[model samples]
Target: MAIYMDEIVKQMLQLSCKLEHTVLNSDSEPEEWVLLLDERQYLMKQLDEGILAGEVLSDHQKMLLAQIHGIDQRLQPIMLERKQGVEKKLREIQRSKTAVDAYHEAGPSAYGAFFDSKK
Candidate 1:
């Protein structure tokens, strides 16, 4: 049981480190960020399963959890900012589409006439 808990904690620590690096690196692509998030979720699920299985964390494991919590605090604001940016972009795109659709619905000016009597 100790071995299993240790392995889970180790993997979580490594993944948390990787996630921190990815979040800090501006050059890291969005795809990579998303992949890391998915991995993090999976690791969290594993941790949950461990707890549900009646596994007790050692003192060291508790310390590791605290470290992970610290990383999470740092990550939250950055992730929320990114999410807001994406949402803003989507809203802009939607507005542009609506304008284009309205223009198309107008379907050009059909009733127009111009006359010059003096030639």
Candidate 2:
């Protein structure tokens, strides 16, 4: 039983590192990053569930958990950056939507009206 629990903890630690890398600075498309971030959350949920299921921890298991804690600490900034990135994206979308709405309300400006009619 303890061995099984130890194995689960090791898996969680690996997943934690995977998640940290996924959230690290990247030049990938936003949608790709979004998918990665979503998967990260799923991984984290699984880790939490596994941790909760373990009825008891041996000293070895505790050491593994300490490693997980270190990984989590390393992930903190990346997670916060992900959150801030999401907020910034939402704000940009809002600004773009407002510009589109205002353009419609004002109708075409002289520049658009002139170019829109012909060729």
Candidate 3:
């Protein structure tokens, strides 16, 4: 079936906006990156299917598809950067958790009584 590329275009645009926000200072969970990856893959598959079907395209859709392609090209590096940010944040959290575990393992005296030694 012929699908309007605008659907994919809007999806790509949203992804670009997300990448922008993710690159900025904010703590994003790993799931957020996974969502973005899924979106990208879905849009790519839609584009491929539309092309392979040789669907009749409207002028607006053609123009929008071109714009979407342009945005995708510009946003590739930003997506990579955001993916790195996500990975780095996940590692930091894991490392922090490990340190806390080690501190607690040192015994109740080190915790200043906030944690009961008996428990």
Better of 1 and 2 by lDDT: 1
How do the residues 1-119 of candidate 2 rate in per-residue lDDT, one tens digit apiece?
Answer: 56666666676667666655665647534465466556646655755666688657779878877887887788677667767998999999999999677657755677556223322
lDDT of 1 by residue, 1-119 (tens): 77887887878888888988998887766788788778878878888898999988899999998998899899889978887988999999999999767665644544563333324
| After superposition, candidate 3 runs with Cα above 4 Å error | 1-61, 110-119
Q: 2 or 3, which is superior by TM-score?
A: 2
* Candidate 1: 10-residue stretch with minimal lDDT: 110-119
Q: Tell me the lDDT of model 3 at 37.
A: 67
TM-score per candidate = 0.77, 0.65, 0.50
lDDT of 2 at 87: 95
User: What lDDT would each prediction earn against the true structure?
Assistant: 0.82, 0.67, 0.70
Order of the predicted models by lDDT, top scorer first: 1, 3, 2
- Please give the RMSD to the true structure for each candidate, in Å: 6.4, 5.7, 6.0
For lDDT, the strongest prediction is: 1
